[model samples]
Target: MGEGVTVSGDIAASSDIRIDMWSKLGSRVEVGGNAYLGEFVTIDGKLLVEGDLDVGKEVKIRGGFEAKGWIVVRNPVPVIIFLFLYIREMMRLGKGEEIEKAVEELFEDSEDSQDFEGKEPSENIMIIPAGAKISPEVIEVAGEADIGSNCLLIGNIRAQTVETGKNLTLKGSVYSEGKIIIGESSTVHGNLFSKGQVHIGRNSRIFGGIKADSVLMHENARVDGTIKAPSGVSFLREAAEKQILVEVNALGKGIVSKARELPKGVLQDDLIKAPDVAEIVSLIKSSAKAKNGFVPGRKRKTARTQALERTRRFTGARTYRKEKSGD
Candidate 1:
C-alpha cells in the first residue's frame, strides 16, 4: 500500500514497517496476530477490530476504534464510550430535557401503538411536564449584587454583594462573595455566609448563623445563633439593654456573695443608718410640686396624709411630719 494508504485487514511485511506520510486502517492490521509491530513503530490510521493490534510507538486514529481482545491503540473506543455514557448520564440527571429526550429516544422506539387485548402498553417513555419548576441559574460575582425589595427569585443565587430589601425572602441560601444586607421586615431561614459585611435590619429574623467580615444588628432584630465576624460587631440598643439585664443577674449574685463575705462590723455599719423623716417629707413635697405644678395646698395635703397613713400600715416608716413646722 501507499504511504497514506489505509487497510481493513492484516499486513505482514518481512522488513521493518515504515511510512513517511499518514497511514490509516479501518480494521485491525494484525501482524501474524501473535507478533505485533516492533518497537518505535507509528500508525496514524484509526484501528477498529474484534482482535488485537500491538505496537511499540504511538498510534493515532480518527472516530472511535475498538480492540476487544487486547487493545494497544493510542486511542481506545471503550474509554471514549464510557466517558460519553458518563457525560450523558450526568446531563440527564441535571434535568436537561434535550439530553434526556435524546437518551430516551435512543433506547426506545419512536412509533406509538395501541394496546392489544388487555395488555398494558409499554411504559419506557416519559413526558416532561409543562409546568415543571426549574432552579434559577446561580450568578457568581467577586464584588456584590444588591437585591432590591419585592424581588422574586426562582433559582439559586450567589453574589459578592447581597442587599435584601424590606419584605424580601429567598428560597435558597445567600452565599455572598463579599457582604450581605437584610433590610427591615425581612426574614431569612436559609444560611447566609459572607466575606465582608452583614447587616440585619430592624424586625428581621434570621434562623441561621451569620458570618461575615463585620456584622451589624438594627433595632428589634432577632438572631437565634452565634454571630461571628472578623472585624467588628454592633448591637442595637434593645439588644444591649438585654445584655445589661443578663449581666445584672450575675451582678446581683456578686453583691450577695460580697455581703456574705463581709465581717460583722461592716454588716452592723450597714444596719445602723437611721431613716430621716424630715428629708422624706421634703422629697414628697418636691414630687408633689413637680406633679401638681406647685406645692400641695390644703386639699392636696389632706389627700397625701391619707395616702401616707395607708402606706404606713404595710411599710416600716411610721414617722410623719405634719406641716413645715415639726409636729
Candidate 2:
C-alpha cells in the first residue's frame, strides 16, 4: 500500500505486503510472502512473515517479529519513487509496452484475487471507482462499502454495510451487519444477508435470495430466490415521497408504521436530507391537497414545452381538416 495507510487490526496478505513510510500499523501483521516496510514505520503488535523481511530506518515492531526467510534492515525505497525509476529505465531502453503491461497487471488485481478472502476486517474500506479495471475477488471490509455506478465487481462483499449506485454489475453476494441499499438498475448475482433492513431500488435484479430484518423493494425489482424478513416486506412502486404519501393516506385511522420510526441519522445522506415523517403525518392529519390542475407527486413541465405540445395538436387537426376538404 502507498503512504498514509491507517491500518487497524491484523493484516494478512497471501503475497507481498509492502507499506510505505511514516505509516502506523496498529496491530499484528502476517504475510505469506515478502514484507517490505518503509522508513519510520511503527507496528504496535507482533509481525509474522513467511518470507523475506525488508525494513527501512526506525521501523519499530514493538511486539517483535518472526520470519522464516532473510531479514534486511536498510533504507527501503518508497513505492512511488521505485516506480518512477523503473519507468525511467524502461524509457531509456526505448520500451513502452512493458510499462502498460505492468499497469494492466496492477489494475486487474490478479494478485488480489488470491487467498485474501476471509482475512480479518482491515478497519478500512476498498472503494472501486466507476470504470476501474478490477478482477473478481471476494473482499471483506470493516466499514461501509459505497460502490460507484456502472462498475462491475466480480466478488462477494462482506462489510458493516453496503450501498451501491445505479447500473452496477456485481457477481457476488453481499453480507452486512447493517442496512443494504442498492441503487436502481443494478444486478447482483448472489444472495444478500443483512442484520438490518434491505432496500432494493427500481428495476434491479438479484439472482439470489435476500434475508434481513426488513425488506423494502421496488415494484419492478426481481429476486430469483426467496426473500425472508421477520419485520416484513414493503413495495414502493413510486417515488419515496409519493410512497410516503400513499402510506399516510392509507392510514385513515392515523396509524404510523413502526418501520418509519427509525432513529434520526440512521438513514442520513450528505446531499439529501432524511424525510421528516412526523411532518408528513401532520400534513396527512391536516388533509393537505393541491388545487386546480396541479397534481401531487408529478414533476411540473415547462411552460414552453406545454405550449409546443398544444400547438402540435392544433396543427394536426388543421392538417386533417384541409386534407378532408381537398378530397
Candidate 3:
C-alpha cells in the first residue's frame, strides 16, 4: 500500500509515511517504522517514532518529542533549530534561576545533534538569537548579517561583508574578507580579523585586537587593544607631527622677517669693527701683562701729561701773565 497520511489523530504506520507537504498530527504522531517528508513540511504537534525521520528540506516541529531513528533535516532547518534552542535558554536565564547545569546539558545535546546530522547550509545570511552559545564552526555569510543581543558564538564568522548593529555582541573572532562596518552601540569581545577596511562607529567598544588593511575610527569610538594596519593609519584628532610642522613654519617665518628688518650695511660694519675692537683689547691686555699690571697706571699718568702740554700750547704765556696780574 501507499504511505499512510494522518491529519488530527495518532499515525500508526507499520512501514513508512512519505509526505509531500505538511503533515499535522494534532496529538501524537507515532510511526512504527520510518517517516519521510519532502520540502516545506510542517509537523505541528509531538512526533514519536520507533524509527527515523528524514526530511529532505525544511521542517518545523512546534511541539518537541522523540525520534528513535536518525533525524535528518536539510540546510535551513538546522539553522532554525539552532535559533530556537538559543532563545529558550535565554528565557530560562531571565526568570532568575540557576541555568548553569541545564545549559551544559543543552550544549552537549546540541553538539551531539550537530555531529549526527549533516546539512548543506544555504549561502544566505543566518541570524543568531540572544543567549545562544554555538560551537566552533566556520559560518560563511554571503549576504548581510545581524546578530541579536546576548548571543555567544564560539567559532569565527567569515563574510563577504558584515554590519553589526546596536546591543549585539560577538564572542569569537570575526573574519571578513570584505569591508566590515560596525554600527554604533555594538560590542565585540573577541579579536576582529579582516582583510578589507574596517569602519567602527561612535560609542562602540572592541575589547580585542583588530587586524585590517585599513581602519577608520569615528568620533567617540573606543578600542581597548592594539590595531595593526599596513596601508596607513588615519586619526580624527590632529597629529603631533603636523602641529610641530606648523609651529616650525611659523618660527621660520618670524626669523626671516626679523633678519630682513635689520640693515645689511650696519650688520657688515659691525662684523668688520668686531675684529678691530678685539685686536685693541688684546694688545692692551698684552701690554698690561708685560708691565706687570703697571701699564694702566702709567697710561693714566701719560694721558694727564699730554692734557697739560696741550693746555700750555693753546693758552701759552698769556694765561701765565693774566694769572700773575690776578685778572
Candidate 4:
C-alpha cells in the first residue's frame, strides 16, 4: 500500500486494490470490484474495473482501459495516438487498391464530365462533409472547397480557395491560391500558406505560422506562431512599433523629430493621443488587432440585430405587394 512492489503475473482482487507510487504490475490488473491507483503506478496490461476506478495523475496504462461505469482520462495524447494509428490501419487494409480503381474509373468517365478534351479539370471542387474522418494525405482541388465542421483531416490540402466550418481540426498544412476562411474553434496544427487573404473566426487556435497576403482575425483568436503578410500590413505593424520607439524616446527626454511621425498616407483619420506608456502599448496592441479585422469596441450581436432591423425597415412588406391605389 505504502511501499513499492513488483508483481509479474495478473492480480485479481474481489474487493478494491490500491496500487501506490513506484509500484509496477507487469501483467494485467483485474479488479472484480473497484480500484484506486496512486501516482507512478504502471500497469503493463489491460486494466479492467467492474466498478468505479479512481486513478491519480501519472498512472500509466500501457495496454487498454475498460470500465463499466464512468472513466476519466487526465491526459489525452495516448488516446489520440492510439486512435490515429487504428484509423490509419483500418484505412490501409484492402482500401488502397479499391480507392485507386475507383479513381481510375472516375477519370475514365471524365470525357462525359464537363466535355473537356485537352485542358486539365480545373473547375472540380471537393467537399468534405461535417463529422467526417479523413486520413492525412495529399488533397488537391482546383476550385473552391467547402469543408464542414467537426471533421478530422490529417493531410495537406491544396486548393484554389478554401472555406471551413466551425470545430474543424486539421493536422497538416493548407495552401490556397485564393482566400482562405477558417471557422471558429478550429485548429490547424501545421502552417497555413495562402497567396491571398486569410480570414480566421473567433476562438480559433492556430498552432503554426500563417503566411498570406493579408490576414483577418476575429476577437479572442489565437495564433500560436508567426504571421506573415504584405507590405501594407507590415507597414501598420511597423508604425505601431515606431510609436513605441517614440514613447521610449519621450521617456528618455529626447527630441522627437517631425520626420519620425507617420505619414498621413498611412493613417487617414486624426491621430489619437496616448497619455502614457501603458496607453501607448495598448494603442499599439489595438492597432495590431484591428489590422486583423477585429474591431475593439464593436459588439457583434448588437451590430447584427441593428442590421437586420434596418433591412426589415428598408424592405417593408408593402414593396412586394402590388401598389394598390397607384396601380
Top candidate on lDDT is 2
TM-score of 3: 0.34
Give Cα distance to truth, residue 89, candidate 4, Å. 56
> Between candidates 1 and 4, which one is better according to lDDT?
4
| Residue 281 miss distance in model 3 (angstroms) | 52
Q: Once superposed on the true structure, which residue ranges of model 3 sit more than 4 Å away at CA?
A: 1-138, 146-154, 236-327
lDDT of 1 by residue, 35-61 (tens): 244333344444344445555445444
Please give the distance, in angstroms, between residue 203's alpha carbon in candidate 4 and its true position after superposition: 0.1
Ranking by TM-score: 2, 3, 4, 1
Which run of 10 residues does model 1 get worst, by summed lDDT?
239-248
lDDT of each: 0.55, 0.77, 0.60, 0.69
CA lDDT, candidate 4, residue 251: 34
lDDT by residue for model 3 (234-281), tens: 655533321111112322331123333334444433322211111113
Write model 2 residue lDDT over 15-105, tens digit each, in one string. 6788877777888899988898988889999999999999999999999999999999985357678888999999899889998899787
Report the number of clashing residue pairs per model.
Answer: 5, 0, 0, 2
**Model 1: residue 270 alpha-carbon error in angstroms:** 40
Residue pairs with backbone overlap in model 4: 136-154, 136-155
What is the lDDT ranking, best to worst?
2, 4, 3, 1
lDDT of 4 by residue, 1-82 (tens): 4435555566677655666666677788888766778667788999999988888678889988888866654554685687
